[model samples]
Target: MSFTIYLRCFNGIVLREALRFVHQKERFFSALVRPLVWLGIFAAGFRSVLGVSIIPPYETYIPYEVYIAPGLIAMIQLFNGMQSSLSMVYDREMGSMKTMLVSPIPRWFLLISKLLAGVFVSILQVYAFLVIASLWDIIPPISGYITILPALIISGLMLGSLGMFLSSAIKQLENFAGVMNFVIFPMFFASSALYPLWKIEETSEWLYYVCFYNPFTYAVESIRFSLYSQINIEYSIGIVIFTFIFLFLSILGYDPGRGNLQKKGGK
Candidate 1:
């Protein structure tokens, strides 16, 4: 297809996703609410109990709420990714996915376009959350507001790709809710989102390793650093690597000839 056609296709997908997001007020509200509850209530109650020492990107001891802010931001992207995946499953059931897949435009491009559309929605949700958090005096550096965009995009794509990958394996729309809970909770709780890896290490070495290797942990850390106008090269690189891995797998999963779709006789 011509480059103009590709551009038009991308714009169409993004516009449709944006309109869907605008109509789904509850989805946007809930995305903000989940993190806000953790920040306003959970963080306040645990502020005294949880102490964060100076770590990279953090020059001194910080409040629990401030520390978990990046994690919560990552959580937004994580949930958005899964929500996009759920939409893919729903589209498949309704025959829209098949229609789109059969289009002359490349399948991989279509999937990536859909993934970027979800990321676009997620970036908006995250910034809204940050604005609300700032009102509560949990602001990051002023420059961070601008600097964190790249990190947000990378993390969003990685998490969204994960959702796409998961969706390819899920056959039924109803089963996806269970699969999402199964994946989301463990990835969130087991990572450094809520606690420092060192603290987890002190409590349990194995759990610490899990946290160290978890891709979500890297996503959180990368955001944490970027929010401070700093960079964690290692974790940033990790996020990119994980993004490619998950995206490649997702493409394979959607392939009609050689992937999961073939096993199901081109579902």
Candidate 2:
């Protein structure tokens, strides 16, 4: 195919998925509400009580709200990414994913198009939370605002691909709840989302190492550093590596000969 034709087809896939999100206004509102509640109510209640240590790049005892805004943004992406992947699982059960797979486009492109759509939706949720955060004077640097866009996109793709990987493995929606309990919370808390690595280290060196190993840790820290206008090389590299790994795993998970989806009676 010519370059322009390929690009147009790619754009069309992205647009169709995006429009599906637009049509589901309730899901969008629900995504927005979860982060807002965490940032506005839960964070506000804990802001004064939480004693944040002076970590590098953060020179002072920043408010809990300020410290966690990036994490909350990450959470939105995480949730949205999983939700999108879950939707794909739903599509498979309903035979929609099979239809999508049969399309002339390469499987990777089709899968990535869906991932990009999820990232786009997650970006919108992140920005909406930022606007609400601004109302309470919990804003990060104005410059950090623009950079957060790409950061959010990268985070979104990583988490979304993780979701895709999980969906590819699980046979039914019935099993997802267990993953939500065991996987989601641990990944979020073990990361730098709610606290710094220094604090986790003070508690236990091993715990710090565990957090360091979490891909979400780098994603959160990447956003935190960008918020302060400092580039975090570790976080950037982590994002790239995690994105590729998850995407590759998801592709394998979706492969036809593997019986990944076929076992579920989805051909």
Candidate 3:
């Protein structure tokens, strides 16, 4: 009976999330469009202007479009993860999150359920982008399709937890836009998403070190490795570490008594 109830709770959370998404179809469409613009318009325009150098994953010269796919994938997940966090903040302000917190289920379970729901939504958007990429002859290996799922889920969890952590820390929606600008763009550009660390190394060794240290860089590299059906041991380890650290911080942030969320300035 206990097991059955647990399953029911999980299913209930999943169902509620799916229904919420269905009701807000425009948001889904808008999320999908953002990445499409980056890939179809931005990448296309800049592919030629940006010259490529030998990078680890690439044995030969590859198109800039092909090179940036993994980064773009990471970008999509980053935006969605942050968006999920933003929605949580909105829900809290609207009182829905407060209701969720009062449920009988463990707080961790509630958090995981929300994380899983965000993962499901982000993965759907990713696959949609992949299908479109295929039409443009930008598909990765057929085997990559299988490996990509787990990588995507890991990246999703990391980003979603980041969202949760940030949501807990920031009191107002107005402040979030500032974070999006100051945090997200720098995180994306400074990583291997736009250029190889080695290339960045030639320009500035410190910037390369920064890229090496950025958790998002590992996530992008993990996605890139999976795209070729090749394993990157460092990326695999980095992602696991990154996910756990972010998750731990998120749990800490969500703790009602000790977390920043309950602070006067946050409200």
Write one digit per residue (lDDT tens) for candidate 2, span 18-115.
Answer: 88888999998898888788887988888777789788668877888888888888888888888888888888888898888998778888888888
- Give residue 109's lDDT in candidate 2 (0 to 100): 81
Model 2, residue 189: what's the lDDT?
90
Q: What RMSD does model 3 have?
A: 1.7
In candidate 3, what are the lDDT values of residues 1-267, reduced to their tens digit? 387776788888878878887899997888778777877888889888888876766777888888888998888899888988898888888878888888888787888888888888889888988988876578787998988988999988888888888888887878889879977898899899987787888999888899999988988999998888888998888888888888888888888779876784444
Once model 1 is optimally superposed onto the true structure by TM-score, how far is the C-alpha of residue 52 displaced, in angstroms? 1.3
> Would you give me the overall lDDT of model 3?
0.85
Looking at model 3, the pairs that clash are none
Number of the top-ranking candidate, with TM-score as the measure? 1
Q: What TM-score do all the candidates reach, one by one?
A: 0.97, 0.94, 0.94
Candidate number of the best lDDT:
1
Q: Model 1: which residue pairs collide?
A: none
lDDT of 1: 0.93
lDDT tens per residue, model 1, 1-267: 689999999999999999999999999999999999999999999889988898888888888898999999999999999999999989887888898898899999999999999999999999999999987788888999989999999999999999999889887889987976799999999999998999999999999998999999999999999999999999999999999999999999998877776665554
**Model 2 CA deviation exceeding 4 Å by range:** none
Residue 53 Cα positional deviation in candidate 3, in Å, after optimal superposition: 3.4
Candidates in order have lDDT scores of 0.93, 0.84, 0.85
